[model samples]
Target chain A: MTTAKSQRTVFFVSDRTGITAELLGKTLLTQFPGIEFLKRTFPFVDSVDKAKSVLAKIHDTAQKEDRPPIVFSTLINEEVRAALASDRALIIDLFADFIRRLETELGQESTHALGLSHGIGDELVYQKRMDALNYTLSHDDGMHTANYDRADVILVGVSRTGKTPTCLYLAMQYGICAANYPLTPDDFNELALPKPLQPQRAKLHGLTIQPERLAKIRHERKPESRYASLENCQGEIRAAEALLRQAHIPILDTSSMSIEEIAISILYGTGLIKRVKT
Target chain B: MTTAKSQRTVFFVSDRTGITAELLGKTLLTQFPGIEFLKRTFPFVDSVDKAKSVLAKIHDTAQKEDRPPIVFSTLINEEVRAALASDRALIIDLFADFIRRLETELGQESTHALGLSHGIGDELVYQKRMDALNYTLSHDDGMHTANYDRADVILVGVSRTGKTPTCLYLAMQYGICAANYPLTPDDFNELALPKPLQPQRAKLHGLTIQPERLAKIRHERKPESRYASLENCQGEIRAAEALLRQAHIPILDTSSMSIEEIAISILYGTGLIKRVKT
Candidate 1:
């Protein structure tokens, strides 16, 4: 039976966003990396018709493939969830399993509503996140230096080194007021921090990338320009690293890291307290 | 004993980003809303020294509080994990519990490594996400209309209705190429679809907000302007919703919704396929 299948199929089925299922499924599948898994997300599977269609797809895959498809679901509705379950596939209803256990343990029944997990249940928390996102956006790339005191962290990096996205992620996910300053070629000439950043050196976190990767990323943006050349990338990276080292500022290499990793690392290294809770 | 404390303290600790711990902890805590949770995150506690400090804080909180502090941790280092455990508090080691079960099920010993879950193990996936983010940022607020064909989803909403951040969230999280177009008063005069959106109606999703909420959000940015008046907001939203309803386009109210909730609802309502997986 093991030899019969070349790869297994996995589905993240949800009544709403399907993000929770995806995160949980991804974490579990990372453990069994040797076995390849084909993944798909089916969100808003709230209706009986949609649930039947999902079940049909699962049964079809089971018949054609040797291994039973693994399903990770967060459907809160009992009728819709019941329609999607079968002996033909290995279905794990995360909500149903955990909600029952939690209800018994807490001596209360769950609301079993759809789309509440990621909702704005608390208005104040939601507003704080929005305010942080706006602050991050307006202060991006050192657009306004007057509000430096309000920033929890300021990211300094060469352009296209995942600075903007990482700052935005930190703000959106954790209600962190993050602002990024681009380390321009002009700054490399002196290998000194910008005057605007001099007073706030304590809040500055640096990001650097591998020279080759930096060149490739720049090449995509401005192909055949001197700014995207390998030599230019190498020189800029070297100077930036030297400046960061000289200033005794901590830096992160983002060449092989995701935005989540970079944001978390900055939070960890800086000890910045999150403004809002998830 | 329960009445002794008005609020319970919860800590999400991790050796890496602490995002997974926070996410899992948030999900579990949502089940028990009766007890207020005062949550804090301590990320990248990889060393014994850091773990010791974390334990000391937990113990101190226990001493001062009427109830034991609850800690949800995802530390992978054996020694560091051991240092964080204390008899004075309730500690749940999420990684140790799951990794062992996964190892036994997969018939392979776990790596027990730190900061691996959010790593850029798949370079292609990372690049795709970066590309999507760039596309979303550049195409924000109908900046450039030439690349509308490249978008998987195009959000339509009146100004300040939260089209920009929602687009960014969709792109950054799911690698969906999301573009947002603002429905200016010029287009609302006829209560018809914008010219650029008519050709791609299937990819279009509408966002509307309550008039009072929209006025308040705009008032924060530009107070005492006609644009921030409740009458202007009510007129704009009424016209926008009429256009969307006339065309049978799916619409969502963003007044009380989070960005994640909006993105997921759009994906579900439109059946938009995610361009990248976690």
Candidate 2:
């Protein structure tokens, strides 16, 4: 008999904000979207009724289709676990995997601890940021760069090339003050580098996203305009890339890559440190 | 001998465009202000020397002081990492964590990846938002009071009380069709509910940020105007709360919580399925 027709989909459910799971999952799913990964997020499905809905979705989906859907669930409750377990699907429980490893490797109680959602890392990240800001305030006027001077690298790109988000993440995740800049029309036209950028030509890193995505972002603010026009964005992006190439600057296409992936690429490609997860 | 000060002071350095990190990090750092965290981002640290200046800041901080500073850098490449990871401080690499996890989990070597940038969730989040907007477009009326019939849960609050940000976040994060309307002077003067709001009081969730916080946020925009004045914000906030309390509607505070946290509260309070992160 032919294999049961399998409908593959990915779900991000979390007791807390499903951000971490969604984020982590996005990266993982990108590597396997052919499975028809349809992403659905259910936040705070803890109560019996809410939990029942989760069960019902799985049950109903299982009964209707030829093959069970590949269900990826992040549940922190035992009852919900029991309810969901009844479904005939390849369930990838986030906690189950991480917790098992933690218990096995660290000999520590992984329950409610290793949770990326409930992890101390979030708190640590928050505190670390506060201290960082205060420190920056005291060490103003570009002086703070001395310590971060270790940043053998910083990113320079146009307005929507995913620079800031990438940098903050780099800083927060690794304590890397990954600096970034936007190429203004002036800079793009003049093609003359800023004084600081001049000496760093060899060290310059650039990121470029798909023009369509950039336009999509710009549309939110000033809908229906040349600035937000696909053609304009594409032209500007293409021109910028050509200029960077001419300048002999190596650039990364941020179109398909996530911020995490981009950061790693810059680190490794540029001969940066041993890829350590900060 | 006294314990040697650890090079534990963390620093976040970025280029001038590093404003991205500052704004993103500002929100994150409020939770922890004691971590000796440092931020030094120069948009122009483009050269080897510029990068060196940044490195020196870290080196000097670590070397000059009894306590060595921990440099969390986001620059791309071995060049900066090599320069920055001097004898004085610990270099916490940001891009490495996600890459390592990705390589370990995905089994395939990762290309350039951006570890985790909080602001970058927009694209994925907005992907599902079209369904929400369309659903709301077809479902909502001006009064929007059909609590049970609402395309999604409704949010009501005084002006500048954070209804907008919360709703945008909900729409972005959970694919939840969230619509927000200020409980304006008219909402108060009429002392009667809007046509749409009256029917869906149960489905109508209320968001109340601390009056002081509301004042602070409004002040940033209006800057001393009556609308943004602390007195106005507090007054509006109080009256709005009175109305909601009178209606016996459940309320959530948006002041202390982040967009993520507030979204979670709504998902849980409304009994919506959380997107599990698997």
Candidate 3:
């Protein structure tokens, strides 16, 4: 072990996009905050030569640092995974272990496909998600208010409360037709449901943030303006909260939450079923 | 097992957002295409009461159905995770086994804290990602072409070729300042980079899709129109590919690829370092 160093080389290896491996590795690494990770992702490692090169790199790092580097891999191919399996370092095969357990439980052997998780495994679902993404983009900030009827969820929030990114994530990741309406100063004055959202109150999901945070976000976008002033932010948040409370709308505070957290919370709070598995 | 049906109830339980459990579970389930899973996510299960309810549900499902249900979990807290650990159903505790292995290798004990993965673990990185997302959104589809100087990567592709979503994903997920430009007939006719992009040629990454797939995608948006015609799609794709090749810009085929694949490919191909971890 390299007791003198606090940093370790970490590899997120995959046969396709290494996003899943990266996410899982990051989640695990977060538990050890005292250790620093110099991370790299090697995606599309679908060949024997590629796996050999990655193994060589791992061995080199281990020899140089006198510590084994961590490898978080999602390589699905048996041949490639077997080639990469070595005793030089800690190799975490995320897919192989789980797939074996699942295969046993279900009494069926898995396909062991290389890229099914993020590939076009189902064309219909992929098409639906793309369509939903387009719809969400077009309907952002109530651009097309008439399309509210087609939306599965309509997020209402003060400007910069993360309405747009949350809507995009829901649509792109979950295939949910999410439309976000920014609560403007005019809408906050009435403290009632906006005219466009009146009939579609069932789909309304309110997003809120701390006043100071909102002001700081706005200040970055527009410095020294009325819109970026703390007083304006406080008033808008107060009015928005009052409207949400009065209308019996569900609200989520996004000041310290990540997009994943916010999206999952909305799905649970609204009882919105996943249109696609991932 | 019920031979008459292919359905199974699945639970994603976690101490925090449950995103990791859901993602890992979904990836594993995709290998078994024959099974139809009705999935549910229970987030913020930090309390013993919450764990008891989840256990009760799992037990109830196992009794109701001839086969046991599947529960995928990433609960970090030992007490809460232990409460739900049972033999009534298949429990895939993602954190427990991996954390034990990681701890042994590092010669250290994990903090075992709850919700560190998606929480505000680093405020600076979170703010930087938010700022980058705003930048990408504002510069979407060649909006504010003058802002190209600030972009870490600018994606160029024909319309409806998965440019916008890829840009957004790169920015939101990795905190890379990504902007996209849609190539029109005018740019193709000129056979040159767009004037605004000429100065930033090093930052350009081109996206190309199969003509047939592009046609089908366009047809969905605008049916039977000239814009969606096969001939037009073919011509534009040919010209786009030629322009990218002649300009020495790397091109990615988005025909059967996913956004995650495209974004990671761009990052690797362009050598753009991620501004933040996912």
For this target, which candidate reaches the highest DockQ against the unseen true structure?
Answer: 3
Q: What is the TM-score of each candidate against the true structure?
A: 0.85, 0.49, 0.96
Ordered by lDDT, highest first, the candidates read 3, 1, 2
Over A5-79, each residue of candidate 3 has an lDDT whose tens digit, in order, gives 389889888998887898899999898887888997889999999999999999999999888899999987899
Docking class of 2: incorrect
**True lDDT of residue B212, candidate 3:** 95
Q: Per-residue lDDT of A140-224 in model 2, one digit per residue for the tens?
A: 2223444444444567777767665455445444454465556766667665654456666655787887999889867864799
List the per-model TM-score of the A chain: 0.84, 0.56, 0.94
B1-278, model 2: which lDDT tens digit per residue? 12332113445543223333333233233223233244443332334677787777777776676655544444434454455556655554433444444344333454332222322344555345544533443332334434336446777887755554455445534567777766776777755666767766666888898878887767766788888877778878888888888888888887756555676677766665443221
Which candidate gets the maximum lDDT versus the true structure? 3
lDDT of the candidates, in the order given: 0.81, 0.56, 0.87
Off by over 4 Å in 2: A1-13, A18-42, A45-71, A76-90, A111-124, A127-155, A159-182, A188-191, A194-205, A208-251, A255-278, B1-205, B210-236, B243-251, B255-258, B264-278
Per-residue CA lDDT of model 1 for A113-228, tens digit only, reads 66666677667777777888899989998799889989888999888888899989988887888899998888877867888889999888999999999999999999999999
lDDT, candidate 1, at A16: 69
Error of 1 at B75 (Å): 4.8
Better of 1 and 2 by TM-score: 1
User: Which of 1 and 2 is the better model by DockQ?
Assistant: 1
Q: In candidate 1, which residue pairs get closer than 3 Å at backbone N, Cα or C atoms, i.e. clash?
A: none
